[model samples]
Target chain A: MNNETEIRKWLEDVMDPEIPVLSLVDLGVVGDIELKEGSVFVEIRPTFVGCPATTQMKYDIESLLHAKGFDDVHVDISYKSPWNSDMITDKGREALRKFGFAPPPKGNLIDDIDVLEHVECPQCGGTNTELQNPFGPTLCRSIHYCHDCKEAFQQFKPMN
Target chain B: MNKTALKELLFKIADDQLILGHRNSEWTGLGPILEEDIAFSSMAQDKIGHSYAMYQILEELGEGDPDQVAFFRKAEEFHNSQLVELPIGEYSFSLIRHFLYDHSDFLRFDMLRNSSYELLAQVSSKIRSELKYHTMHARTWVKKLGTATDDSISRLQNDLDALMPYALGLFEKSPYEEEIISENIFGGEEELRSRWLELIAPIISKTELVLPDPEGVEPVMGGRIGKHTEYLQPLIDEMTEVMRIDPDAEW
Candidate 1:
């Protein structure tokens, strides 16, 4: 029987498949974990509803726990409290920037999409970026161009 | 609660997303530019994902499997608005349709965020945020092309004029409208239409494109109760082709 701290620590090794630099815990979508009657019950909250990574993330969690001797594991996808960009850890934010994608701004989410313009560039740390498209190659990312670095980059866009 | 009414409401919304998702995917490689290609393709995935979510709810209410329900149904068995079932005409037409469609969708989901049906409310809250990107994408392109040049402006305006009547069909009253509204499962399509107009008015007014007087526009309705365009069956056929060939095949 492992404690919550030890279980979460073990989850740190389970990285986001798309953004390998960030872990599931760091990405802030491991909704909850409950140890009941010698079984592990995990709540996996998907960052984006359409994100296919959720399916993979669930598999990874289940396999990891199963390998850890939790035979009666229950991993339920919970949208109960939904994922917001603000959930990303401070450590995760730095990891995102280091990985060349701007971490979503903390608590700057608005319903207006134009507010997405001029996200600080992860390349040169410049605020002179322009939004190329609010959509990127993936559902959770948005495209932007940095004026200072003259580079097209992706940002893990903020969601409220 | 009127379970029948709730299911009807869910089916129409889900079917709209599914059909429009197929239409959006039609632009995958054929978009005017690489970015536009990716944009449409991304949106197509989101829309289809939404329909899948809705169908999952329907299944909980005792409907058939989501895959079979989506692939096996004839066009007339679907309740999506005719606006969504139409062919992707020219880029201008598609853009206008996208703009008109997503705005209504955004508003619809936004309203559902507070639905008395807790499951629907939870799903709607998640969906509302994603749809913001869609509306924003539509607005950016409409503004850019609507004001770009005479040709762009007139092409968009013509499409805008042509699409409005069908867009109005989006609000065709449900037979279960009273039940849905009474149960607070939804805010009703008429209310959604009015809110949609308010949401889109300033955006459209900013462009050279004129909003057709919806008052004079005879809405091309009946899709809500399963009537569809000739285009819908063909689109459904294409969508289900692979699935039909191998219903039990692994992806």
Candidate 2:
């Protein structure tokens, strides 16, 4: 029953349904984990309120914990605070770039002169890239094209 | 007292988001610029996600599964406004529609944040934050393109004029509008329309685009009661293409 570190280790493998390269831990969506009286309670904050993946993520977490023999598991969907792209760990950013999607800039888009002007191409590492679209295939992504590689890629959008 | 009325209200709002999200998604890979392609896709996903959230609320009140409710419904069964169902035509038309629809869309969410229905209120509070980005994106484009070059301004203005009637369809009142209002599930449509006008007018004024005379234009109605244009069914068919192929398949 004293498998707290093992539980955390198990949770680390739970990937974000949308961006599969990043885990819930890497995305910073997993908040507090508490165990009491043989019951485990975990809090997860969604990337967006309407994210469909949030529902699946909850189910995945619960099932994973259940498979681990933690029968009394409670997954609380927390809306007390919103998730920001900035919460994405440096490792998560590298994973995103490695997946061929440009990771969102570290800080807010408001700090930049132009939101599109500065993104480095994930494919060719080119700063001389053009913004193809400020919006992309998903709510958290935008499309960019690199002049060097001439490849069209998606960038995880910078969230405010 | 009338649960049906509340369901109708929810259905229309959900349907509008779903249909428009589909339309916005069509811009993926086809946008004039790649950034816009992604932008439309992002908003499309957000809108569809919002619709799915609303559908889940409906399921709590005894509707079918969200996937079936969204993907299996016929065009005639849909309650989305005509504005949303229309093809995402030129970039100007889509942009103008986004500008027009999202402004009212946020206002509706703002009103629903205080809904007497606990679920709707909870959903609204969560959704409103996401929608702020939508409105910001819409407004920024409307302002940027609306004032840019002579060609851009003229194109945007033409779109504004053309889409006015359809845009007004957004406020077509529910048959249970009074019931919903009486129960505090929503503020009335007239109230939302007025607030929408007040909010959008100044922003539109800032652009070279002129606001169409609201008094003279006739709002296209019927979407609130499930009547849609010829376009909706085909769009629905396209959206459900994969679902129809294998309803049991994991999307």
Candidate 3:
């Protein structure tokens, strides 16, 4: 298979350990995958600087590619353009919703609005929620308390 | 405090962070689970960031460039205690190491927040906020592992027995320790050490684990004076390889 095709297939099996439903490529954290000469290069942007999954993600990628006969694999971390919920592909969002996380509201496009207008609860489908903390499970997400469900859930926010 | 003393103090703080950060980064791809993978990596990054910040302060004080001060320093010049440089043996060992260090770090930063040096105090304040999460994360894992299956509890206990003595090394006094205290650069080291033990005792007790006696345990010093474990050289080589390749090149 060609490099692009090979990378796309490799990434399909690379699932997010936390959410399980989304792959790194689907999450848009996998910025670019290229074949230079005989080597494979993967570029990723971390959800946040200190996100612990980053280390594991690098290791998993290397092993997976190695298993596929790619001896030279380079992983580059880019922090120039910070990550945001908007980067989540439509397919990823769908997968997340099916996996029980209330995906970003269907009508609220990330680019159309400057700030998150209303974050719908992942549980109980309620719009009535308040931010519980700026930090959630990780720095990339914010904890929001759903008044309807009375449960705290993480909402992926745009990093500024 | 004299300039020499201030520089030593900076080295102590920076060396602790550098070594600890290196240890944490080793867990990047090997975490037991993904959620935890993210958590541990973040802590490592915060530590490295803190180290860089400390190095920057030293640079301004005419020590050297941040990278030079961090990467080129001799092993004997480093002031970090032995606690941070220890290997991250098993998962339990790693957890115990973090548990002891994170709590002590939190208290240290809190005290440093009131330092006579305004810049130092401000930096401490910023680092303290991030350290709160680090402490929470470490505490959660300690509780989870401690209360889990019997095997897990035993593993944690064994790890604690092996590493607690090293944790005491964090309080080993440097020549500048008294100078900083007298000048109010920061609070007294003995008082801080006592407070650290007091804060950690209940946490350790809650885990049903006995605090290992640290009496007469000679600290494995020289990290703060730049004598690092064999692990550090290889780590620094890889971490700075790219930067070193083109020192004059801008990214």
For candidate 3, write residues B125-151 as lDDT tens digits.
656655766776677678877878889
Off by over 4 Å in 3: A1-160, B216-218
TM-score, ranked from best to worst = 1, 2, 3
Error of 1 at B239 (Å): 1.0
Instruction: Give a tens-digit lDDT track for model 2, residues A37-117.
Output: 889888887777657688889999999999888899999876445477788888888899899988878765633437666
By TM-score, the best candidate is 1
lDDT by residue for model 1 (B1-251), tens: 89999999899999999999999999999999888888999999899999988998999999999998989998879999999989999999989999999999999999999899888898898889888889889999999999999999999999998999999999999998998898898999889999998989999899898898889999999999888888999999899888888799987
Off by over 4 Å in 2: A1-28, A31-43, A50-56, A71-138, A141-160, B249-251
On residues A33-105, what C-alpha lDDT tens digit does candidate 1 reach at each position?
8888888888887888778888899899989999998898888887788888898999999999999999888
* Candidate ranking (DockQ, best to worst): 1, 2, 3
lDDT of model 2 at position A36: 90
Best by DockQ: 1
Evaluation by TM-score, superior candidate among 1 and 3:
1
Chain A of candidate 3 compared with the true chain A, TM-score: 0.81
| Each prediction's TM-score versus the true structure | 0.98, 0.79, 0.65
